[model samples]
Target: MAKLYSKQKLAGQSMLPKKETIAFILNYSKALSIKKIGKMSFEIIAN
Candidate 1:
């Protein structure tokens, strides 16, 4: 599960809800920015 402080921001960016798990089939060869947050954790997962 992921946690987010701003649901509006996510919505504005067309991202899924924090508690929602999303699955995609597309593969990217470029860099992307992803943020992961938990109750006591904050992480950035990107490539």
Candidate 2:
């Protein structure tokens, strides 16, 4: 979970989604792609 207060403090009291949140989103997306690749590879081998 992203800490809203910490993000606000980091941005000098500015309002934003926070860099951590963006990084988490990016990382999650990459993980999803990796999972998809694994599944595809398994399907190919099974076929």
Candidate 3:
């Protein structure tokens, strides 16, 4: 179908997944939470 073709083209262009999309997948699918610990350092809390 045309939709499938467009999806494949977009995937080849590396423009389908944005930063937020990746972050959401990692943040929730991994069962982890992100919190502000310091200015630069990051802390991973299990949910």
Higher-lDDT candidate of 2 and 3: 3
The candidate scoring highest on TM-score is: 2
Candidate 3, residue 45: Cα displacement in angstroms equals 12
Residue lDDT tens for model 3, 1-47:
35555556554665477889899888775876456766665657576
- Candidate 2 per-residue lDDT, tens place, 1-47, comes to 76567545554766789899999888776555322564473222211
lDDT of the structure predicted as candidate 1? 0.45
Model 1 poorest 10 in a row by lDDT: 20-29
**Rank list by TM-score:** 2, 3, 1
| TM-scores, one per candidate | 0.15, 0.37, 0.31
Per-candidate RMSD vs. true structure? 19.4, 12.8, 8.9
Clashes of each: 0, 0, 0
**Runs with alpha carbons beyond 4 Å of true place in candidate 1:** 1-31, 39-47
Q: What is the Cα-based TM-score of model 1?
A: 0.15
Number of the top candidate by lDDT? 3
Candidate closer to the true structure by TM-score (higher is better), 2 or 3: 2
